[model samples]
Target: MTDAPVLPSHAYVPGHTARHTEGAFDPIRASVREGMSSKELARTEAFRAGLAFRASGHFWEAHEVLEPVWMACPPNSEPRAFVQAIIQLANAQLKLRMGKPRAATRLCQIALAHLDEVRGEVVLGCDVAALRVEVLALSTSSELQYNA
Candidate 1:
């Protein structure tokens, strides 16, 4: 079998670094909120796994667990964005563990924005607005605590 094509890394760009590509969050939100996609986002085993991992401070594992759910989402669905935001939040926590608070903060900011798309709606068994506030407070804090 032929090898898959290699994608370029974003490391070469300064100040343009992001966990996800720019402008990719909006469509996902619109799709979910508007019911543009048929895929229903239930709190499945994978979702539970991600939550468990995040709660246990296994941030990277949480990201891994939630990714498939995000991928299974129909393109531009709110569920997709919500999962992606959770993944981003996990990533931010991981970055914080790695002593990169700035990166973590930035990722949290992106996550908060994504969360804003469906603030009042309960998706993935979470109060999206409350989570947004928590993340926002974390991002804005002078120092973030681990497993916070």
Candidate 2:
């Protein structure tokens, strides 16, 4: 295991952050309107925060923050699939942290499947090709390391 990255004050990581006992961070307090454009959705604070949480090893919080953005996207659209892939990635990491390697591998496979639905090389700020490679590696790794 490696040291966790420094996260924003408002970011909450379950078991690691004291603030989680009070309440999980809710980046989306209300339902997001459906049919929002991918560019517009990508610009939202929730999306940015979600990515930040994931990068900081706060996988649970990242999934919580990104779910609304995923819900807001048009069904079957590349943006929806992209967000779903990210959410699955977060879940995969969380499962790894929980010592559930089988679950993590399954989730990584699901994430890769979702990635296939995306049409662009990049979605939002994520490099789709790079993400695919990362997820595939995670799925096959026998000994994975994670941050706190």
Candidate 3:
């Protein structure tokens, strides 16, 4: 069978990441403000928290926090798949964080399917496409083979 892809460790070399963190946080904070009501805000806050966890390399925490939101999204819509994709993607991320890139790559394929099916621009502030490109870079990298 064909092998899954892996990313190089140098993927984050574009620039200093922390400088861009504030811009990333803006939409999340906006989402919290634009929520329909307190309940909505609460839910959005949970998602924002999950994003923070994901950014911090705590993929399991991201998964635990995001899975419910993904699962709770209305059954037949882009947002549902988006969240579900995030959950699945987070699982793969957790695998990567734990140094199991092959398993992570497998999970990423599942996550990619859902993410690809999503419509319009990102429903939330999360940059799934950029994340996809990044993950794809890692998943397809030769460096991950033996490490896997």
* lDDT for 82 (candidate 1): 85
Could you tell which candidate, 1 or 3, scores higher by TM-score? 1
Per-residue lDDT of 64-116 in model 2, one digit per residue for the tens? 77888998988898888989998999999888877777778789889999999
Tell me the deviation in Å of residue 126 in model 2. 2.4
C-alpha RMSD of candidate 2 = 5.9
Tens-place lDDT digits, model 1, residues 1-148: 1122122232212233445455432332322232323234453545665666676776765665566677777776577778878888888877876778888888998898777666447776676777677678778777764433
* Per-candidate clash tally: 2, 0, 8
In candidate 3, which residue pairs clash? 5-139, 5-140, 6-138, 6-139, 6-140, 6-141, 7-138, 7-139
Give lDDT per model, in order: 0.63, 0.75, 0.59
lDDT of 2: 0.75
Candidate number with the higher TM-score (1 or 2): 2
- TM-score for each predicted model, relative to the true structure: 0.66, 0.79, 0.64
Q: lDDT per residue, candidate 3, 29-50, as tens digits?
A: 3333321432363357557666
Output the lDDT of residue 111, model 3: 75
